[model samples]
Target: MESSRNLKMKFDDLFDVLVKDLTENQPADTSPALKWFQQVLLYNVPHGKKNRGLTVVQSYEFLIGEKKEMSDEDFKITAVVGWCIELLQAFFLVSDDVMDHSITRRGRPCWYTVPGVGLIAMNDALYIESSVYKLLKKYIRNKPYYIDIVDLFHETIHQTIVGQCLDLLTSKEVNLDGFTLDRYNAIVKYKTAYYSFHLPVACAIYMVGINDERSHQLAKDILLKMGEYFQVQDDYLDCFGDPELTGKLGTDIEDNKCSWLIVQAWSKADNRQKEILKVNYGKPEECNLKMVKMVYEELNLRTVYEDYEAKSFQEISKLIEGIDSCLPKTMFNEFAKKIYKRNK
Candidate 1:
């Protein structure tokens, strides 16, 4: 695997340039407000593992192959596009923390919880989202594929919001009487897969001049499955990962999340086990969380996760094998390997 640290240093340099531009372009007298706005933007962005942004550069590299050398100007432009994806991610996460009533993100206080930010964090989130388009227009507007890139950004945000709506709706309708595997899959695909896994690479493909329908469809098919496995692993980690390393306690059980574990447990549970889940899950107390974990252990949820992890790896391998190597396999393969057994 390539060093994520090395990729991240390059991203940080790109991020610094963007911030400097935003700062330098502010109104002469009201620089303080710009500083605050910039601070909010910078703080919220750049804290992730940089996998999404790096996927853009790596995918572009794969697509271009050896035909064209990556010019310094090319690297800078692609890095900006990658940063736009990161900004979009920040937009969702800030608002999501508020919606989830989460207290922390990336190990700091959630933006809404910071003193003096409060509900304004909602606007701040929007500002981050707007910056994505602004940067896109600034850097890529003259390119022949400019319209396609703009359309992609809009489509990705729309899909993510729709998925989020499904997720919120599912949590509200957790009657278990109505829960089914299909519904669970729908929630996963929309809420988690599209933006996290598909959109970033798709954006790079468009940049690399591979905007044809067939190429897009091929990338989406593989990326969406990768997205599913990514979220499934995330669901698994919530229960079993080290909190010291993962940086948060598992909340899916208490939040009544439509996680793979819960879905599987519900599917296989007897009537009595179902009743226990109904009574104990989502109770908003430590004791209730303990009860839920107990039930999970009783159901051998660990083994279930292990089984799924192995199966997901195999599925991804098969998908990659089916891909024509003429396409950018290294880019997608790099992403797949990083998340396959990620601990944090």
Candidate 2:
């Protein structure tokens, strides 16, 4: 827990530096567009817990053994690149909130919902997108792996958009008759796993000069599994976690998310249960939440989550053991341990 706190503090400092640089580099003259861009970058990027960006630094430290201390210059450059990924996440979330009609994020008003910021948040999201490339070019251009990093980021964004499209399409289709375990996994991998988990760690691996196809493929395989586990836990927490700890009320049921818990519950439910879910799952009403949660409790969804959590931990341990000890095991293992039983 202490290590996790330190990692979070490091991420916060990096975010602050990146935001300061963005503001300073903006045009000196005061203009609404410039002001809006600054506000968008600041407000949206810094709101989250910064897990994604910190994963880069943590993975880098893992790959390049912490025994080999990083220079201040190297640490600063890596931190800046990590912050770039967070900025990209902000770009996606701001636009996604509009498309999803999300009213709040991280327990606060969504960027679009803020005063005088409606609709303009779309362009602000774009500004955040542009900033990612600018930071990449500035910090990584001279490295031999620069092109790979750029291509990876582009491919990741493309995959996430594809996943997002599938998600939107599924919500509208409304016929749960088509939903399957395979489709749910596909959406989770592309839409959530790749960016949330793979992109960050892979970026760090590339920075540490591990661009070999075999090494990257191995790293991605391990990281994607971790990503899946993380998202599964997130889905479980949405319904089961304390709102005070989670910072928002659970909405996966209300939103009809194709989450892991829903997929599992649907698989085991009887026809009668399925009908009840179809009617109540996605409706935005207080009574509907009660109905869906009742179904989850009746099915003992918490027990299912416990079983999955145990299996995921074991599988991750196997993956870690298989990794060549020549690489930094402690760093990767540290990351794995931090996330394995997280409560908040």
Candidate 3:
């Protein structure tokens, strides 16, 4: 019911409260561990667009009807759930950056890459993760859904970490023989989709008192598909998207990432093209990079991506249509619109 600007401001206020509360709970005064925790929390948690956090608030409001008045207390609780999702994301990304040996995030240095931080960022990531439970307990301890929410977060966390393990191991493999669409879907579904897409809406569902197993499972089915599509687009963009718009240069090529483009390109390559890719796919040198791109261009991978994008939208739209009336279809529709045709 509040304007988007007002809602965002409120979300920030609740987030600050959680941060301050968590900071107070940490060890007293100037300790290195405390300082590391504070620094990691500030840099990684709040730096993103906060889409996951905002989605909780937005989905709750949409489900309950924006025309319905929202109390300040209820709004704050909902916002806290959103912030919890952000914290979960921070937890994953900090560890992910370290694992991937990434250098930057959101156009800034990765937390681990920060001078004097280094491997400690992994532990800081743990602190960020632990903060989620801290906030949930402080705010939602007495709520009926507390156990359910905690369980959901734990399960999602487990799923994501498992997905990350799959991704890390898959990336480490030298041969392209293992890179297939099935593996790509598995990695994305676990590593990115669960936390990014499903967790936020599912949290809001619990908050809004939709606890029926059928409804929850239906939502999961719909959202996980959307999540998979979201990651596919991410893979596509990492290779073909504009760096300025995407906020970072594409590195999936050099990183030997199991990207959608790579899979599609591999599937379509002639023997010569396959030989070219074999010679040059994962090398970091400029000539190798150029050769890989040459293969992509020759195979018209860009057009393939366009066609795939169109089909993904159609499939997801049909899924949205099939969502039961007991659930708010518009909530899913709104989320789909946000991600549909996204370039960044």
Candidate 4:
């Protein structure tokens, strides 16, 4: 993998081009609506690690072979499509912060939390979403797979919305009964996996002229499973990881999130442990947080997580091994390795 510095430089270049294209045609008068729209795009669309967007370009290069020479236009178009995926992510995140009542994102105040922005962030989120198609039409409307690309984006966004709805319902009520492993899988697969893992690679696949129905389904199967494991690790890290390394303190316990740790701890708890959890699991108080952590330790949930990681790695390996060369196994392997054993 390239250094983060190199990756950031490349991604920033792509983002710069995208921002220019979006704003270059603005009227010279610069109306308030246009100004706010520019700020919305600038602030929300390009922040974060940008791994999801970067994956699209990287996966495509892997499929086409790094040694193979790609034209300047080919490279730029792939990078722009990658940025479009990032715009979609920005759309989800801006609205999610509003819905989740989150304070900060990427180390700054969320767009909605900024003074005077208020609920206007909702409309800004929609604008970011619409920009995805705008970028697509501007860059690749003439490509053979243009319609397929549009359809894939539409489907991925819809799947993520379904996952978000499930997550909202799960977290809407603070009942422990609702936090099941099955529900957790559903939420992660749709909300996080489809867009993060499946969409990027699927776009690359379609771009490279490999559109076999069976191949797409097989790739989805592998990627969706990888996405589930990726999210389970995210849940584990949210509660158990070091805040210094993670860049944010975990609120899953206090927030009553349907986290993997809680479910595992619940399943392993004794009667007294269960009662302790019942009293303290979702409380915002420091003592309640302490009590939940104590129970998690008693249940050895960290070890359980370590074991799950091993099992998941093995499963993904076996699946990748079984894949025929419809798409390059190396492409999927590279993607999987990035998420495997990640701490943040």
Candidate 5:
């Protein structure tokens, strides 16, 4: 608990550093843009749980445990990279809310929804992405793995954009036939897994001098599996989660997202249930929403998700055990434990 608290404190302090460096140090002539960008970062960057960013720090610590304790400078460098991950996360969310026409996020109006923001949020997202490299160049360029980190971030961003494109195309048509597990897997793997799960740990690996294909492939394989599991949990939370607890209203149903819940519901539903879903699945009206929820409850998707969650947890645990390298199995375990039965 103490370690977690200290990490949280460090993570918050890093946000202050990022905000100051990016927003306060610019030329006075650039102050308008810089100040606007500051509000963008203030609203979007550091609000969430910070799990992905902190994973970089935690994974680095785990990988280097046998070597030596991290110096304060080492910790700051890792946290800077971690905050870059958070910036990337913010970029995605801010832009996604705009694309999805979402209103709320993290228990508040999304950056795009805030007064005077609207579509300007897209430019803010661009600023966030550009700042990622600036911060990286300033903080991490001296490291041997500098180029690798840059390439990894660019690659993951492209993958996420492609996933978002596929998601938009897929969701454009609300046919129940479109929401398959295969498409769902593709969407989540590209959209959420690469950046959220693999990239941070990959950064840690490169930093720790574990850059071999064998080790990275192993880490990517396990992490993507866990990432898939995590997204399924997210899909479950979207439909069933409390807005007060989850900090945002779910729009998957209204948006016709290729979510795991809809896919499972479609697969298990009978003809009558399918008809009800066909009538109600994609509409934003409350009556339609209630009908969709009724179908889900009647099918008992909550129970189905509970079973799948338990099974996936067991499967991922075994996958962690099957690791055959010098890579730390406990690091994978730590990642797994964070997501295994999480509520939010």
Candidate 6:
């Protein structure tokens, strides 16, 4: 991959162009509503690792190949679609923090938790979601695949919401009986996978004018597996990762999330171990956290996670090798490599 320094410089340039389009280019620049809108974009978007947005551009590069360069306008359009992915992510996070009652995000207070924002953050979140279409309409309205691209965004947002619903319900009462691998798979596939992995590649696929169902299906199957594996890594990091690096505090345990760690640990625990978990698993106390973590250690859950990681990587690699399509193997390989051992 190119240096993140180079990627950020490119993304930042496009971000300025987008800001102007939303503000000074269209409306009265001095309007208070425009000012608040600008603040929303400045604070919530572009702050994270930019992985999903980057994936859109990189995947398109792989599809377009070195011999056939797109027009400069086409290049900017793909990059802006990538930015749209980031905007959608911001929308999810701003609202998710409110729903999850989260404190910190990206190393600072969540939008909802920021003083003076409160419930107004909900409207801001909607604005962020709506902005994705606002962007697509302006930049890509004339493309043949414009309708397809719009439908893709609408479907992805819907799938992610469904996944979020499953997550909230699963953790509602913290009864360990409901924390199954099947349940975890569903949550990750919709909540994290569809948007993070599937949507970006699919967006690029449509951009390149490949509208056939067979190609899309093949890509989705492979990418969904990658998404599940990525979330597994995320679950591992939430507990063990540095808060300074992760830029968010881990609350999976306290929040009764059907996290990969807790579910795997539960399945491996003895009756006595199970009883210990039942007593302390979802409690918010420090002692409770230690007690649950101790069980994970005794079970060697970290080792279990490492083994799963290696196996998942191999499985995905093989799936890519066996694919039969115009979609480049290098694109899938690049994506697999990016998420395989990521720290943040």
Best by TM-score: 5
Question: What is the Cα root-mean-square deviation between model 2 and the actual structure?
Answer: 2.2
Task: Estimate the TM-score of every prediction.
Answer: 0.95, 0.93, 0.96, 0.94, 0.98, 0.96
Candidate 3 ranges beyond 4 A from true positions: none
lDDT of 3 by residue, 1-344 (tens): 67889888878877667778887666566576666667678888887889899998888888888567777887888889899999999999889888888777777888888888899888888888998998999999999999999999999999999998888887776888788989988999998889999999999899889999999888898889899888888888887788767766677888888888888888888899999998888788989989999999999988888888889888888988998657888888888888988988
Give the winner by lDDT: 1 or 5. Answer: 5
For residue 89, what is the lDDT in candidate 5? 95
> What lDDT tens digits, residue by residue, belong to model 6 across residues 1-344?
44667766787689978977776655565588778888888999978888888778777778888877666676688889999999999999999999989999999899887778899999999989989998999999999988998999999999999999999999885579789999999999999999999999999999988888989999999999999999999999999888988999999988888899988988999998899899998889999999999999999998999999999999999999988988889889988998888887
After superposition on all C-alphas, the RMSD of every candidate to the true structure, in Å, is 1.8, 2.2, 1.5, 1.9, 1.2, 1.6
**Strongest candidate by lDDT:** 5
Better of 4 and 6 by TM-score: 6
Q: What's the lDDT for candidate 1?
A: 0.81
Which regions in candidate 2 have their CA more than 4 angstroms from the true location? 1-10, 25-30
Candidate models: Cα lDDT each: 0.81, 0.80, 0.86, 0.85, 0.90, 0.90
Report clash pairs, candidate 1. Answer: none
Q: What is the lDDT of residue 313 in candidate 6?
A: 98
* Candidate with the larger TM-score of 1 and 2: 1
Instruction: Give model 5's TM-score versus the native structure.
Output: 0.98
Candidate 6 global TM-score: 0.96
Which is superior by TM-score, 2 or 3? Answer: 3
Model 4 weakest lDDT span, ten residues long:
1-10
Q: Model 4, clash count?
A: 0
Can you write out model 4's per-residue Cα lDDT over 84-166, one digit (the tens) per residue?
99999999999988887777677678899899999999999998999899899999999999999999999999999999999
Between candidates 1 and 4, name the one with more favorable TM-score: 1
Q: Which residue ranges in model 6 land beyond 4 Å of their true spot?
A: 1-4, 25-30
> Could you give the candidate ranking by TM-score, starting with the highest?
5, 6, 3, 1, 4, 2
